[model samples]
Target: MAEKYLIGVDGSEHSRVALAWGLARAAERNADVELLHVADDSFLSESVAFLSEAQQASQQMLDSETAYAKTLGFTGNITGTAVVGHPIAELEAASKRVDLLILGAHSGSRFAGSFFGTRAVKAAATAHCPVAVIPKHEVSPGAGIAVGIDGSEASKVAIAYAAEAASMRGVPLIAVYAWMAPLTPGLEYLWSEELVEAQRSAAEEAIAIGVAGLAERYPDLTIERRIVQSPPVAALVQVGEEVETLVVGSRGRGGISRLLLGSVSHGVLQALPCPVIVTRATA
Candidate 1:
């Protein structure tokens, strides 16, 4: 069966970017594309009079986005859907059947708490499949793929996904591992150079363990290892600025809940430098 990519479209420029990205990727994988637009039923539930108008508006959005998708010159199957419901709930439920879910990143006060903005983060956190959030701006020219590694099972899964993507794109893969020295308030002056070196060595080992099988798995792929002595989010963000796409696990070692996004993942979403892919290990 051909792979399928589900994209959430709201007729905004951001969603258009996501639609284009999804179509290009679908063309590469020979996958089908589905464009979905959901009208908030909460606002219309109280007024049955506006239900028809809302539905009509939703269908118009679907039609417009569908027309836009066609202009992109994608030859694959494209399906457009319009539903009256909660955007997050609809997208989350649909994610189960699709190979991947793609959305556009929207931030700032105008999009605050809306599905185009903060809700996208929530959807990524709870979606069953891997979610790719494409930013509005273009990525750095000639940038390669980058993934964060922290020795967690989730990070391991992310590494595998990123490696496959890099191989498919014929681009190099950069595996980044970041660490920070323990800063005990009272012992700040006792920190020594040897301790810093030990931490650095440990970070190297963690990255090594994180990418143990990449060389054998992806023989033609070039891998770059980055060890930074900073917070994981900061290091990944810096790498993101230089990469075409930044891939990260939905949660890391410190995450205990399956329904929540980890701090690092959440942080990167807030300050996205490029397209970000949030990968979750399948249960």
Candidate 2:
């Protein structure tokens, strides 16, 4: 089978933007595109005709999106698939077979909590491969790739992927490690400037060590390290605005064994200024 890049399309502008981005990215990576449309099974019990009509409409939408992709200058092989079932479950099953899963950040349905719903978060965290969630925005010129490294297995995977993406895009890679300095409740007044500098230096050093091998791997890729003294989500979102893509671990609750969608990665998906990719570590 051809290396497939699957995209979930709902005819929303957000989904269209995601399709466009996915097409270009997949083309650059020499992968085929599969446009998937799913009809909610909730209405399947309404009537047989309703189910049939809905499925037909979904197939039409997938065809429309496939046609639309060609208009966007995507000349690669494209396939459209329509089905009736739970959207998340169907997509989850498809994810195992595809090289990558691309999704629109925003959904028109009120059921989806944010731009990405609860299920989207779960899918990103649990998918077998990396999932790229594209916001309703275009890539800006000269923007670099940003990845968060927090000394976890998932994050290490994310960093490596982000570095490779940056290398492919011919841009720099910004590796951000957000940290907070711990202070004793009553000993705050005794803190010195040297102590603050040491903490900041330690944070930077940690990030540097985390990506030490990337330089050798991608000899021509430029890697910049940033140590932020704020929450991880906020730091990554801020960086996302200035970068082309924000890549992060699907799960990392600031611990070794905690490999699941945490608040930071969750927030970045919803509010990041650029496209965000959530990656799972290789087993």
State the weakest 10-residue window (summed lDDT) of model 2: 107-116
Off by over 4 Å in 1: 108-114, 252-259
Query: RMSDs, each prediction?
Result: 2.5, 3.4
Q: Estimate each model's TM-score.
A: 0.93, 0.88
| TM-score result, candidate 2 | 0.88
Each candidate: how many clashes? 0, 1
Instruction: Give the per-residue lDDT of model 1 (tens digit) for 1-283.
Output: 9999999888777878888888988998899999888887875655766777788888888898899899999999999788878777888799988989999877632421135667778888888889999999988744799999999888888998999999998899999998999888899877899988988999988999988888998899999999998999999999999999999996532233555788999899888889899998655
lDDT values of the candidates?
A: 0.85, 0.81
lDDT of 2 by residue, 1-283 (tens): 5678999888778788888889989888888988888877864677778878888888887888788898988778888889877777778788888988998876456431122555566668666778888877676856899999898887888888898889998999999999876666987877688988998888877897889988889999998888899988989999999988899986533333333576778888768578889888765
Please report how far candidate 1 places residue 7 from its true position, in Å: 0.8
